[model samples]
Target: MALPVACLFASVPVYAGEEDIYFSDLPMVASVSRLPQRLADAPTAVTVLDRAAIRASGARDLNDVFRLVPGFQTYPNNTDAARVTYHGLSDEDFSPRVQVLVDGRSLHSPLFRNGMNWALVPVALEDIERIEVVRGTNSASYGTNAFLGVINIITVDPSVVRGFSVSANHGNQGVRDYTLRQGGKLGEAGNFRFTYQQRDDDGLKDQFDWKDKFTSRLFDLRADFSLSERDVLEFSAGHVEAVTMRGRLAKSQNVLIGGNNPGWPIHDFSQSSTYLQAGLRHTLSVNSDIYVRYAYVSDWASDRYLNQSANPAYNYDEAGDQGVRHEFEIQHNFVPLDKMRLAWGGSWRNDAVRSDTVFRGMSWVSRDVFRLFGNLEIKPINWFTGNLGLSTEQDSLAGAHTSPRVSANFHITPENTLRIGYSRAYRTGSTVDYRANWWEGSSLNFRGNRDLQAEQMDTWELGYLGDWRGWRMSLDTRLFREKIPNRMIQVQNQVEYMVEVQKIQINGLEYQWKWQPFDTTRIQVSQSFIRIDSEFLDSALAGPLSGLSAVPRTNLDQLGERSAPRYSNSILLMQSLPFGFEFSIAGYWLDKMKWTRNSWQDRYSRGDVRLAYPFRWGPRGGELSYTVQSFEGNHGEFKSYGQPADRVVGRRHWLGLRLDF
Candidate 1:
């Protein structure tokens, strides 16, 4: 902190490109502070991904857009198991540290212990307007589960999506996609838009044991109404249904059910989700406004592993959970003073899950949480500003806790600023961690202790943002440190325990640059480096008790580091060509990443290119494009085995056509 302060006071000049496709914008973001504030004044580090970056990446999946972010990692794997993790806190399947939201609705599945199911996400990439990512802890604004970071996705407004549009894509690796969307003004009223999409793919053919074959269909609708000059209403609904291959194929089985034997077949995971959201905003005065929102979501999944096999149950739904979530929230925004602004909100949520194996002898389990949060921004002088935020949450299982954040910014100039910030965040254990009593063939049983507690961490950051006029570019840099008292990890011996027995510290640095040297050419780069240190607090308690093998984590070493690569960087170059043609290329490189204590992944690099022809005719427009991924040959990004593959990836090609009317 002292050194960074000295550097800030010295006014060290930073060099980088300008904002290319995405620039961390403050005034335009509502997810960071909950109040409208300048990006320069936000309390923490932020990364913004606009629509241009999304389209420029030629990404087949929405998660690919994060490759350009300073500290995000895009692991290439079977679509069902792929991960988009933040700040190096990724270890295995089901990334639960970060919170993901679409239009303020959570995308986590209760049946899976709050893990994000990327396959069933209802929002389509084409409908996204922008993504606001908090690069550090933000539980002070987003609530309890917002531990490491937050990814808030805002979709295109209904009013902006006019007429009708259709698109299709065909490529290698059994890739097939089709989309249809329509938007129009209601009869003398508001606006309504709807979209339908279907995607099918057979994952990497080489890995057959746990093949990644899936097919999914999605549908969503949005309606907006302007009741009067000061009142507005918005309603949205969406549904997704998907079937994915899971586990090994049963060679032979003879199980009797009812009057006949049910033949063993391909073990597949079936998933379906539906959600509805509504919000109303009313203006009370010139500087004050109030908004109320409500959302309902239901998720269902069935897996053979989740069901008890010893009892020979014919029903699979008894294994996994059929869950429902209800959330209601209200917020107020106002300019209380000429130089001060405040945004305050409160919310309540109820979650209910029904499972026979997870909670044996219990029909269902329910939990409730209540949260209150507020953020205040004050600009006393033109060159100095302060932002403060705090949130209090009470959970039925983990009691109550509060998180707070404070930051002070010194404006060397309007285009250059220095910020110093600190925050404290708290995370509650997931339902699976607190209550897990499942049997898998008698020998491998997963049991959960009834006395699991919450975890806490403190973060400190020094950040700088500059827009260099002389160089025709923008640069953003940051240094951060975090310390955690108790981090959660799974302990498996004869039984399983979710324990927090490690004290860990992390130090990191990040840089982002965007340069537009000429109007026809653009170049951008982003890089990040991080280091982690851990100490086992209870070494003796973690060892084996008698004869059974001890917990796998007891032999942990520092090499894992939550499976986050030590460093990662990406570069993008885009150029405009004659005859309505555009050309762009992107390259990504990651340092050696570790997945488990014994498994080490070597460094890998990959690249992609997009070539498109755009044309306009009167009022309608369309584009024809071709994209090639993994253009630089194969490399490994994750440490998964069975069959050796290139880049742990294979070459992919896609041809797409989009038309608008």
Candidate 2:
């Protein structure tokens, strides 16, 4: 691995273009600490995915795009929800350790176990301006759910997108997608944009149960108004409806009858989500500003299904869940002194959930959360920088907690810097993790325990950033160690519920490098190596399972240690071809890993390529492109517990056409 990386950076021609993108020495990030700072001066390491890289990767969804980030892992899902994690300890069907935001609005909600739903995200790829991903814990700034990392998505300004655009995609596996967008001047001092889109595709093939498929339709609108010279107003609204097929058949009638639970029958699971957001910002002076924001989100899913058993008395009904959230916040950023900057904010949120299937007979369960946070940065000298951050949060479900962080950056030279940082973060259990009461037959399938405590994580990291303008190359690297004393996990069998049953220590090294070799050629590469250690607690040894001795401790330890792969790598290249043509290729390789304790997935390597051509006719212009994903043949990335087969991914080909009018 080291030899290949060294050879790539050994020698390159001296070529620069006016449009070449370089790693700047100035503070250039806005999402890490709620303040804009140069990458070298920031408190933590961050990866920026701009529009050009996003387009060049040829990713149709947000989950696939994260593959470019070091230490990040994501897998495709058919009927089930997709999952994404960093330095992972992942759940079977949900990713609850990371926080995600879009335009300052949190996507973490009770709807999907306090995690973002990749399939239900309302915004289209074309509307995204850039994505900034903080590579470590940031609870000191964002509060809970920022346990492992943070992802902030910034959208393009409406003023720059004035016109009508339409696009269509057709491909194998019943893939059909369409999108229409319009942007214009709303009034004398306002701009607005509207979009409608629909995506449809046949899900995984050769499934054990039912033939799976996915469909979704969405509508989004945004408007920005200049109320005054110092005050600006922004409002946005979006809605999405998704339908997916789920469930599996029984292997045999005797096996189903003996277990007292029948096989899952084929069913349609439908979900609908909507959100409204507004914000007002006032510039008090050249170096000071204040913003007030409010948001409301609602999500509902209907997963009704019937279980069939050999005995008629064992039949049962399942699935109907709904949730809503309301939040308000105010923030202020100012230059306090000659060499110091400060930012402070406060927020209040309310979340409510109602489910007959998940919560049994519960009508509605609600929780209120309040948070206060502040960050201060000081640059006492030209070569030294220090940062301090703290956050206090009060939650009705998990009580109150405080998080703090400290960091220092030393500029070794104009083009190189080194950083050291330490921080502690906390993660409260989600609604389902703390309030669920699922029942099946005469047993408690899953029950929430009020005595469960919030999980805590302590992290220490050393980072470096170097840029070589002459070679048009840059590299960013980090070495980190994370310790979680009371790590949480969900137990199986009777009385199944979430509990803190182990201690976890993770050590990892990851880096990303970029180079623009020529005016028309660009390259980006990233790699990660991780090692995890775990120790089981007494609680795990004395679990609530009926047959406690049947489970082995080695299996329990593997659950935490093997959640993340030992090594992973990605490479991408984009080149401009002759005659207005563009060519790009990307490849990914990951080590063998498991999504759950009882599931197993083998190591796999995959490649994707895209080719596009642009043309013009009179006043109209358009682009036609062809994309092939997973070109390396069939492979599996995830497996379900107790299932004999893994989720196999096969090759797919799609063609896309876009027109601007």
Candidate 3:
């Protein structure tokens, strides 16, 4: 079936054109500019994810969402353990290096290793307007969390919608879900929208009787009032709340050693968050306009490890993050000269983070941090564009640092554009690396690196883009080499029952491609190759450092060999059939990679399908749909040193109904 579909796509005749369609016409997942000027002129690799494609693919979470994106990868640690990786290097969590935004507000958590709690992101497949993905470095434009890439999610506007809609679904693995949405206009300038959704299911795997569940509610209100013929005020605010319960796996050996207790120690996690944003825009002249934006985000999470016998004691972990940012932008469309137009802008932001932990009537740890930053952009010609930006920030604990960026774009022809860009990106070291006082179980203390310097990277890229009628394509390849004078790593020795830690720097490259061969089908592919040279390591910790932790112990040579096969790719197909019917299929594949001082090899491939048909009853409409995910029942697995590999267990299926009036 897939072969015939591929043949059909290959047989289609290529369309041709001279006028380049604006980037605004591309479906986006995030709030990018509604015009093509920024996308065409910006000196970065950006890809847009359309809503039609998203609906067709039937992705239920961030993992599935990123499968269609190139150069991005994800690994499931267990039933409850999932993490994203980019540019070949990844932390326990990838949030700090890859910034994610919903409607222009950053979703990164300043308290939790700079990673966003994916379980709390208030995004529903049905509400997505578009997603804008920028690959390579972007710390200069979006601040701290943009080390490797940026994912921006945009939701539908209230003004363009009318009436109410509802949907219900059920599927494999005991899956059940539902969604409710309402949107319409009020009076002359007010528009409002509200959406509610819930999901619950016994996952595909049988390990620990895994159960996945979540609930989300969102509200958006917008008001447009004209103060004068030349000025107008636009006010908007959005609020979202989400909650979920996640399950984790316990090593069988650990369970057996402790006794034949199945309920030994169960790991369960939960998260909740609320986000609010508002913006105003005014036209100063026919050629110029100015706008301001503000946002407030609050998030909380709790993790529990419960002992199942006698009087079960629960070790509780809790944390919260609050952020506020303000931005001012100005645009002028008038040409400075014939064939040349100029646009420029500036932005400022401030972030605050706090966290705490507790176990058996004791305060484990606590910390707080604050950061301030600013940036700018400029365009000199219609066919040629340039940008120069810099930011200086200070952390209460990590001190201060400065970053700079520069980029240029030149139109080779109306049908082809060339781009060259460079940026310096950095990430503040985590508290665990700075202030952990004790090991997981031992009384031995680990001191914090107060003098630790931020990890920084120098990234450069060359890209080309072309568009012709229904055929659109883009290719961007980047080379990144980073230097971390105080890089951090945690090492543990099982043979000698000892532990050692240190830091080192590295370098790498990323390649990406986006091709849409038909109006109903699109294909994206991304690959990354990285090399790390650890110039420092304690030679005395031989066996554990060189044998057990040989992967990291190798320093430069070890880093090089360990960094191969760090790549990911995916393909998606969606078709709108005649008579209100639709069908979609998507496939994703990722290479095995490792994390921590432990040598772990991991990899997996999966596919999903969705079908829907609409029916009408008088003036109302309704639809029935069916979805099957992980149709191949692929299981994720990880191998650790001296220990048997652990498999990530789960699969899912769903059926649903929707109504509109």
* Per-candidate clash tally: 9, 4, 17
lDDT of 3 by residue, 1-661 (tens): 1112122222321111101222213221111221234355655767666665566678766556776665666554233335554554553453456788876677775445557656555766776766778776666556556766788776665665678999988876556777787877766766666777776555435433333444445554544555566555555555555544444344465342332233334444555566666666555554445555666665555554443433434333434323233333333222334433333344444444443331212233333333333333344455776656555555565666666777777877655667787778776765545554332222233445565556677766666655443457665555655554433444444411212233434455665565666654455565666555555435434533565544445543343234334555566666667787878777776666555335455677777788888799998898888888777875663444554334444566777899999
C-alpha local distance difference test of each model = 0.74, 0.82, 0.55
Best by TM-score: 2
Model 2 clash number: 4
- Better model by TM-score: candidate 2 vs candidate 3: 2
Put down candidate 2 lDDT per residue, 1-661, tens digits, no spaces: 1112112111211112113433323225667777777788889999988777788788887788999999999987575678889988885356889888889898877867788777788788878877889999999899988999999888877887778999999999888999999999987999998999998988767555445788999999999999998888999999998888877654563233222225466678788889999999887776778889999999888877655553443333333578899999999888778788888999999999887766878888998999999998889888998999999999998899899999999999878889999999999998888889876644567888777789999999999988777777789999999999988888765577888888999999999998888978888999999999998776666664335554555666787898889999999998999998989999999998877776766799989899999889888888999998898888887776665554788898899999988
| lDDT of model number 2 | 0.82
TM-score of 3: 0.78
**Which segments of candidate 1 are over 4 A away from where they belong?**
1-27, 76-80, 249-266, 305-319, 441-444, 539-555, 558-562, 596-600, 641-647
Candidate 2 weakest ten by summed lDDT: 1-10
Q: How accurate locally is residue 142 in candidate 3, as Cα lDDT from 0 to 100?
A: 62
Q: Indicate the worst ten consecutive residues by lDDT in candidate 1.
A: 1-10
Off by over 4 Å in 3: 1-38, 76-81, 208-264, 305-383, 431-447, 470-486, 490-565, 578-580, 596-601, 614-619, 637-651
Ranking by TM-score: 2, 1, 3
